[model samples]
Each structure stands twice: as C-alpha cells, then as structure tokens.
Target: MPILRRFQSRVKFFKASEYMQPKAEVQNLKHMRTSHLVEPNLVGKHTLHACKRLVERILTHKEEKAYKVGIVGTGGVGKTTLAQKIYNAENLKGAFSNQAWICVSRDYSDITLLKELLRNFGVHHEQGETLGELSSKLAAVVWGKSFFRVLDDVWEPEVWTNVLRTPLHAAAAGVILVTTRHDAVAHATGVEDPHQVDSMSAEVGWELLWKSMNISDERDVEDLRNIGLDIIRKCGGLPLAIKVTARVLATKDKTDNAWRKFINRSAWSVGNLPTELRGALYLSYDDLPHHLKQCFLYCALYPEDSTMSRDDLVMLWVAEGFIEEQHGQLLEETAEEYYYELIHRNLLQPDGIYFDHMRCKMHDLLRQLACYLSREEASQIILEN
Candidate 1:
C-alpha cells in the first residue's frame, strides 16, 4: 500500500465540478452531447493539409474499422490547435450522435478520468462506492452511444487502455482522437501510423508572427521588417513560441532602435529566454507541484538534444537529495512519477522506452531555459567537469 499511497499522492481528489451542469442522476445520462466549443482558426499550408487529411478520413469511414487516430508532435507545435479545427469542421459536427472533449493532463488518474467522463455525460454519483462499480456505472452511461471523444494531451497509453471499452476500438462507427507528445503512447494505444506534426516553415512562422501583431506584409517598412524577421528566426518555427513573442511585441515601441536592443540583449542575462518564449514555457514549469521543480531543473545537465537515460536521471536525482522518500515509497518510484509529470506537461520528451531502460530528451529551447533558471546549479555541473 506504500506504493499506492505514493501514486495516489499525485492524483488530486476528484471533486464535483461546476462544469457538470444539467444536474442529472447517473442512470439518466446514457448519452450526453457536451462539447467545449473552441473557435477554430488554422494557419499555414502544411497545417491546413494536415487538417484536410484527417477530416477526409473521418468523412469517408464506411467500416466497422477502428477510427482511433493519434496526432503526435513535439511541445508547442500546435497539435491541440489542429485538433480543435478538425473537431469543429462542418462534416465532423454532425458525424457522431454524441461528443465530448476531456483533457487528461500530466497529473491524471483513471478514476478521476472516469468521473469526469461520467460528469460530462451528465451523471451524478447517485450511488457507486467503489472504482469498479463507478466504472460499471460509466459503461452503462456511455454504452450504446455513438460517441466522438477527444482525449487531449495524453501522457500514457494506460489512460486509453484502462478506460471503458466503448470509448475506443468500439464496433460502432464512432471515433476517439488522441493528441500526445510521445510516439510510444500512440502505438501502445493502437494507433499504427500516427500523424506527426513537424515544426512550421520559416516563411509561415513570419506570416503568423506578423499576422498576430497586425503588421502589413508589404516590403515598404524595410527596417521593421528586417528586425521582425530576426525575431521570428529565433522562434525556431514553433507556433506557440512565435505567438508569444508576437504578444510581447504588440505593446512595445515599434522603432528600429528598440527592436535592435531587444535582439541584442542576452537571454542569459535577462534570466528568461530568447524570443520571449519563456513566459509560456515557464507557466508549464510553474504548474508543477512543488516536489518536481528541482527534478525538472536537474534535466539541464544533459546537453541539448542529448537523450538522457531515465535510470541515470533518477539516480542523479536520488543522489542529489532531490527526491524525498515518502510514505514508505521507493525513491526511484517517485522519481519515475516526476519524470512522467515533466513529460506530460510538455517539458520533456520520451525518446524511447526499453525493457530495462527508458530514454528521455529535452527540447533545445527548454534546455536553454533550464540553464537560465538554474544558473547556479548548472555552474556546479560545469565546474565538476
């Protein structure tokens, strides 16, 4: 039970949500159409093509064949944005008899996830006392329904595999679309060939940056255009990063000298990040429960783009006293959970998982941020070498 407590420590107690409206009893909600309507605005040619392909597949599916499609991409490449656009498409709107959107974030639990699903379907705990009973109640609530579900930001395959059967791989003609940052998660959940979202092109990146800032595409403003392009270049084709940088530029002075000064200022000295991307990434980091912050920062020791061995990272965290033993839990187990949290939050990558070892990597921009944040700790690593 020590391990159980340790794992349960991470799962927040599932609370009744205000989002659960209609106020129906569990038996009444066998099918509910709860849709969190996100307004869809997709950009760039490649992104448009990806959306078109996915929509085309859904529209033409005439089989009992599985409709489990996985959209895989690195953090900030905009998988969620693409998913929302596809979900809101005209064809997709009437494709299923029922639909719901649930975000299974980094800190997630099957029990909590089930509760959320039941709540989304307009169910109230009019009676179950155990998880299995709750599960049975959930199955009964969703059983016979033709559903379109989106499990956004899935960090583990178990989230899908462990859910009620009809939610995925059902014989009925419904679909469950998944979005994740891990390739293995896609395969483990039965997605054979996942749609991989690559970074945007430089031209597309500049277009989005300027579009967000309401700047003209004309070539007349040569000085401003040149500086803006440099800023966009530093964004490295990441849509979220470029968007955040554009937000920062929106309020600033548009003079050539001001833009030049921002470009020349050292990201390290500012203790933030290049291109103003730190604000976005830092929100992800800051969302981590206090226990995992040090472990997340410890990742900076591995060089940029280097695949850090999962076991090695755990041991290093243990040695450095970053992981405190809790409720008779093994240090390694808590450390593993810490790793999963970081990956789930889009702060780390799951490169490969082997029988004996799991490999993880940090993105280049995130690595830059970690070093900037942990300057003193990173200097210790540099000195020991």
Candidate 2:
C-alpha cells in the first residue's frame, strides 16, 4: 500500500506541472488547428492582385523604412477581405515574425480596447494596471521588431494617430495596413497613396454570383446564366450587393418569369439599391440636424458622378435659400464653406479636379443614400418628378 501511494503522488505532481506550463509555448501544441484562425473568404482577381501588391511592398521594404498601406473604399467594397487575404497568405505569414490583426470598429479609442489588441500579440499585463501601463508593455514587445499589424475597418483617423501610430513608431521596419471606407481617414494616416479597391467588373461580378448561388442544373443552366448576368449588371459591380442578391435568388425556384422580374425591379438598380456601404451614410444622414438634412438634400440637384463645383453647389444651396447668409462672408463663399464641411464629413468625394485642385463628387452608393433620405423626407418631390 505504501509503495502504491508513493507512485500515485509522483504521477499527480507531473500532471500539475504540465498544467502550469506557459500558455504561449503550448498554444500551437494545444490549438494546432488552422481552423482556429479566422481566414477571410476573399474572391475575385482584383482582391488577389491588391494582396499581391501589398505583400510585395512589404517584402521590398522589410529591411528599409517602415511601410504603412491603406486600403480605402466604400464599406462592403471588400477592403477587409483584401487586407485579411494579404495578412494570411502563406508567403506573407512566413515573412513576419509576429502578425496581429486588430479591428478598429466605430468606437475604437477605448484604452481597454487597445489593451485587447496587445493581448492578441501575446502580451499580458499584471493585474490592476491601467491601459497606459499596458500600452508601455506592448511597446516593449513590438518595438524594434519586424511585425505585421492590420487595423481593419478603421473609422476615425484620430484613433490611428493616437493608438496605433504611437506604438508603431517604436517598431522599426514594421508594416501597418489600414482598411477604411473614408479617403479623408486614409489621408490622415500619412501613409503613401492608398490602394483603392473599386467594384468588381461585370464578368467578375457574374462569376461571384454564380459561386454564391452554387447553382448546378443542365436544363436551367442557360436561363440561369442569363439571369445571373442581368442581376450582376443591376448590382453596379458591387460585390456585396451581388452576393446578397444572388443568395436571395438562390432560394427561389428558377423560372424565366421570376428571373426577369428580379432583373427589372428598381430596387436592384445601381442608383436605387440599398447598399451596405450606404448604411453609414444613412446613419450620418439620420443624425443630421433638421436644417442640415435639408441643406444636404439640396445636393441631389447635381447629376450623378458629375463634379459639383464648390462654388456652384454652394450657390445653388444659397439660391434655393438653403443657407442663411452671415455678415463679412459672401453668400457664395459661405456656401462653399458649408460644402467643404460636408466634404470633411465624407458626405461628398472629390471629383479629381476642382477650380484647379480636385473638386467633389458623390459616389453612386452615397448619392443613392442621399436620394433615399430626400425621398423619405419629401415623397412628393420624387412622386411628382
């Protein structure tokens, strides 16, 4: 009995030691499954090409100066998808010693949130410390190291300037990638010219729709293919709209009349569809003070994809009596100032050339959002016109 008891005690001691081992060392052994990593499903050649460019840039400058890559486009335009694909690509993964993916959601400035990012990088804090302490600890871990950090869905530029840039400044030769829907935010990052992710082409959009549908039928294949192409055209080459519409169509029985109806609906029109990219714009529109909403709605008078001269847009607003003139500033100049404010808020995009510099244009998606809000406010305008 005494000999058996001694052997049992030895076995229990070994088990406790094993359990107490550092988690970081055992992470691979315990989790070894690649399934644990959230791999983004990125489709289309455009996305793949962007990823290749990013990887090449990072490699080319790995030993030189730090590189920051900004992937900018409308929401649901596949910015995050492209960034993730590049981050997880086998070649890129092997090139960096440490890789961290952080999501900078709408409200990303909370210190606790920043600490969570550091934790993902395998840095832990002592109990009862503030975020500043944690930030310093993270700096120590990342500083002077070759690291790959991806800030996904970044909304506010200040968040990047304050939280990310500070720590990143310490990490020599590290690469930072930011994905944002706002060009102003990209500009604020002080990174090189952003790689813009535009909507997919018609061919690519149709291919994506086909994949998303998972359609397979010999008799109906021809009809379905035609419907898919038509539907893709209505999607304005936006991948999100294409995928969502395709999924919606897939559940319905395939029929010529049904497909035709789907293609003809104004709701599917590129200028009318409610897009995921427009959701943020809608929120901003909704939050606008009543007077501002009216002022913004007056912008729809401009043509789609057409450049609205800052002077012209403002003058129209003033002429239509949208702006209240103040002393010292000319009414046209005041109106231009208001237009600039809207530009700063991302309510309008630069049309590539203004009175010399670039002027402003609303994206099709944003224009649609503005029109929808306008219609909701004064249904009579759209109904009568």
> Which candidate wins on TM-score?
1
Model 1 alpha-carbon drift over 4 Å, by segment: 1-41, 62-66, 166-171, 216-223, 268-385
Residue 79 displacement in candidate 2 (angstroms): 0.9
1-385 per-residue lDDT for model 2 (tens digits):
2222222333354346532244322221121111112222346776777788888987887765347789998765767667767777778766776777765555344464456556767776566566577667777777777777787767788776776666656776677788888988888876678999998887788777766666656556666777767766666677656654654566456886787865655443234335553322344454454545655665554434344566656654675555666899887776776776565444664443234423565544566666665545455444556
> Please, what are the lDDT tens digits per residue for candidate 1 over residues 1-385?
2222222232222113222222222222211121232312346888778888988876666233446788999887878767877777777876776677766655455666677677767887644356676677776776656677787778898887776454434335566788899999988987768899987777777777677666764652454777777776666677766664665565567777787776665541334345544544554454455667777766665433445667877876676667877898899998887877666554665543244337665755577666666654445555766
Which 10 residues in a row give candidate 2 its minimum summed lDDT? 27-36
Each model's TM-score? 0.60, 0.59
List of clashing residue pairs for candidate 2: 351-359, 351-360, 353-358, 353-359, 354-357, 354-358, 354-359
lDDT of 1 at 335: 89
